[model samples]
Target: MAVKGHGMEVKDHGMEVKGHGMEVKGHDMEVKGHGLEEKGHGLEEKGHGMAVKGHGMAVKGHGMEVKGHGMEVKGHGMEVKGHDMEVKGHGLEAKGHGMAVNGHDMEVKGHGMEVKGNGMAVKGHDMEVKGHGMEVNGHGMEVKGHDMEVKGHDMVVKGHGMAIQCHGMEVKGHGMEIKGHGMKVKGHDMEVKGHDMKVKGHGMKVKGHDMELKGQWYGGKRSWYGGTMSWYGGKRSRYGGIVFLNW
Candidate 1:
């Protein structure tokens, strides 16, 4: 562990610095290795925990934890089994509400976390986190929340959804969603499924790349780099190609 100005940086080999609690400025902090376990920086004050095991690792803090690879908390109290998970704040006891996972890689959990649906599962890139606004994922990653942002050559974003999975593609807020092909966008109750792709929300913005008309359906009308926009159900859409935008 290399001690920087204040924030203790942990590079490579995480096991070496296990259990060494450092101070993040004033916020007590502690980090563990890949397959190790460590208590929170504030312990009971926050009760954050991190438990990891063979490809299945988790970082728990502020009531959030990331349990890896099919872990079973075989206790007489809270019996919850999970793999690659990050759960935090929001009074934990009340789970099973809206759980959103990114990629094939992670989960987030914690307090003040707004869960949607009685049984909602979001697929991300091997990253997960819950409560108090938490996220876990990297590279070609996708995050679903009230506000998400991504910038780069390859990127796709929807209403509160930020997805980056390609090259030369950059997408901004809800006003736009770019999927290669000169900014291929999908709007209307935005939902990215198998074949059909929908991008819907209050606002959107996209740029970068250009190509043939693919698919699009929205409520606005505009032309960026020769892209067209359509409208329906009193909503507006400014698309450049074919998109699946249906209620």
Candidate 2:
């Protein structure tokens, strides 16, 4: 069936067009202009109760549902079930999930979940993340009531008996703390006050010596004069950097 614009084209058992080239083919239907296209076994749009089968379903605005096989959605009460699922904003809900997402009231249930923003709630295994006031329970606990930002590098903090209170955070590696808020590390070693952190490999010492040390061989003993040491490589050890002395 072939129908073109500006009204009136008709064929029984399929092919009905009225204004702006709307086309319908017996079992394989197509409608143009305002953009509505339908094929056999499932397709519905605009009124928002969208349906599609054997995968590939799309819905825009309010209460969306897609069953089985890779589902993708955009805005307003988004829902996805089983197999490579992707979702976008507003009261987001995912079941037996897969993920690639954008923000707003997030909720995810089981199976390789990926992340985005806003009032987060995640339950059950495999979580990958983005931002916004977090609360994660059931074996992969990330409970941040105010703020959380994780920039990756195999960062792991697992909890069952939780106690994490930070005014600020940035961990480069090993044994972390920022009481009175201040820490920055580039090697090992830690201690801070006021706020500043920078380190570049081995032999670290701080006693009110407002920091700044660069690579290779620093055999400690500089109290408050812009620190220095030389010969860059491994083994001549003792870095343990980041002990802020009011800078």
lDDT (10s digit) by residue, model 2, range 51-158: 222212222221112222222222212233332222232122322221222221122222111111111111112111222112222212122332222322112222
lDDT per model, in order? Answer: 0.24, 0.25
Best by lDDT: 2
**lDDT tens string, model 1, 119-192?**
01112222222221222234211123332333333333334333444432223433233243222233422333
Model 2 C-alpha lDDT versus the unseen true structure: 0.25
> What are the root-mean-square deviations of the candidates from the true structure over C-alphas?
18.8, 22.8
